[model samples]
Target chain A: MNWVWLHKWGSPKWFYALSGRYLPWLTITSVVLLTVGIVWGLFFAPPDYQQGNSFRIIYIHVPAAILAQSIYVMLAVAGAVGLIWKIKLADIALRQAAPIGVWMTVIALMTGSIWGKPTWGAYWVWDARLTSMLILLFLYLGVIALGQAITNRDNSARACAVLSLVGVVNIPIIKYSVEWWNTLHQSASFSFTQKPAMPTQMWFPLLLTVIGFYCYFGAMLFMRMRLEVLQRENGSQWSTTEIDRLIGEHK
Target chain B: MLFRQPSELVNPLAFFTLVGSLFPLALGTQPDFLRASAPGLLWVSALLAVLLSLEGLFRSDFDDGSLEQWIVSPNSLAILSLAKVSANWICTGLSLVVLAPVLALMLGLPGYCLPALMLSLLLGTPILSLIGAIGAALTVGLRRGGVLLALLILPLYVPVLILGCGAVEASLQGLPITAHILWLACLTVLAITLTPFAIGASLSISVTE
Candidate 1:
């Protein structure tokens, strides 16, 4: 089997070049989508009959929550790739993705609490989704803590990889068990397999924001990965030449 | 082998009992309140005690270099780590299970709940030991890993805590507890089959570093 394609993706230099070329486009797309989606969601979307304007928080809360969970899966997959292939880029991806996941989780929890106050008459409840999301926040903190505790870079990355993999396996079990433990909140409002109960006006911008959040995540990851790649590859000929060329262009 | 150091076995059991006693004192010995809160209180205490003991699970061997030798041996690291974790379960987890009845009585737990408590602890503590071993192995090389270990392992312990407490709660309400026990057993089996390799891999990383 041809291994060149695999090697190309694995190479830090190739990733650096490719990500650089597309970084501006990703940034522009994400900024535009996020702006348009948030503006439309906030102003144009009709208010809920029951909830009125409080439900506007769903646009941010839903996207952040979705991104929080999906980013974890991405972290685990990247970690697995690094472990199996020993790819430097995969390790960078795993590390860079974690802080972003943490922020997303925090945003989800904060917005959820804000949304909860007006809707549920309290800022917090032992609802299953809230509890699970809190646990996800802890899980993210654990990954970040473990990565920092170890002094060795490669060892830390691999250790976090094993941990995220274990966490991914446990995610389903945790979700179900927490659901069983208590479920005071309403059932899910959005699902891929089922048609949403709300009209398109309410959900369309939500869809846009979800996609926008993903693009934003990609842009963030690529930005962080590029900086990390340059840091790790410092003093190497290609990196030095790249730096010199950029400096020359700036001058 | 763990029995040689009696403190290793005794400390966690003592911690469990001490933690169990504090609840009644703080909550004012009201039997109804105690009875209602007994299941959750007992499980949380047991979980903390198990986490406390896990800090030392591999510390001695890791310090003395036996962990390195075991890794390099012809025998599989997974099996070797499994043996180590099993010894830990017997010393700390089993002792907690056996000692829980006295604590249950202190907390005014009903007689019918005792069997369910014992059964749940029996099935659930092993899962704690197995999963905690992975955290212990991961942090074996760090100088200050105790708090970090708890942070890493506690979130993973949520399902066990929920199921174990749920089993006892079910018995309290005269509900069928077979489902909770069955789920706990399934979690134990999954942990047994999967965590040993994680423990092995984590140990290799810690030892090599």
Candidate 2:
């Protein structure tokens, strides 16, 4: 019955301090997992019988793609929270998360294209998944562009929130329609879902990378949110004291 | 109001026709090639024409201060926003639908695909106007919102574009297009019911800022 913990998230000072404590641990976990996962997948896991060494790209491709989509959903949810509850931190989260989402989408698209050259025999094709991911990239760009175009911080956050909410509603419809259109064209040379299951060795590292990517995202988001909080709360007692202490410690 | 300002209707129709005609010239005048590409070409042109018309959807009102008046009025902003978008669809989308068959024929589309082309546009264009109105509302307060509006709105137009062109393409190949039509209808209905609230909310943000 205790909602007090939830309310604490509304306070930027509390979130910044709490996230500061957790950031080092999150960074350490993500760095370890990513290093282990990449090394294991690259060196130990068996190559695809069909794709050969090119299959290793899946370690990067799949996690980035997953994070890209997850970030969009998170952005939308955070936007909704800001809209409904007027939480400034949620607004910051929504704004700060977009550039990271854009990078994830770019990584996914680039790696997918690189992987495609060896596997699908072309760097690009109008495949359903590829097209939808491309659209997702545009959706993120739209959020970032909207945020930048409006000068007022509060207004920009609200506008971006509405845009992201509408986009989240449309993402499924866009994906389904793209898939249906692909079926009509009948040009799907390789389907990700139809691939046979991977061996335990291949997939275990993938699982690690996926979790690492999520932790990495959390650490990055918290870091960005803290910076934004400090900037927005500049000259406030807590931020001033924190900055003075950091300066004092440096001496 | 649209009739009084005939260019509002004429401009998008002209844009649609001009873009449709450019394809055959650029792609060569081969009838078969034109026919094959006509559905996508016409659909994309129509989409762009609707987008072009959307830039002005709230600009004049916002500048004239009527948009702020609508916010302060007793009537619901959602209904008023819906009415504005509907008027926009009538001026832009409806005109494109009615004008599409002429362009389709010119592009060498067979007689059989004509009905499906018109029907798909009839169902699809309203969704374009409704959704684009949200973008228009969001940017109505900006000085140079034209390019940003297109960037924001075009990605969202993908599904409607796919379904619209898919329906016509199916009919071109003598396949059953009922599924595409039904999906287009579903999108239209969903847009009709949902986008008004988004438009209303976005307009308030734009205006209040």
Interface DockQ of each model? 0.94, 0.90
Clashing pairs in 1: none
What DockQ would candidate 2 receive versus the native complex? 0.90
| Candidate 2, position A59, lDDT | 90
Residue A43 C-alpha lDDT in model 2: 98
Q: Compared with the true structure, what per-residue lDDT tens digits does model 1 show for residues A19-91?
A: 8888898889889899999999999999999999999999999999999999999989999999998988988
Give fnat of each prediction, in order.
0.90, 0.86
Which residue ranges in model 2 land beyond 4 Å of their true spot?
A183-196
Best by TM-score: 1
| lDDT tens digits, residue span A197-248, model 2 | 6677898898889889999999999999998999999999999998888889
TM-score of chain B of each: 0.99, 0.98
Tens-place lDDT digits, model 2, residues B67-178: 8999999999999999998988988888888899999999989999999999999999999999999999999998989999999999999999999999999999999999
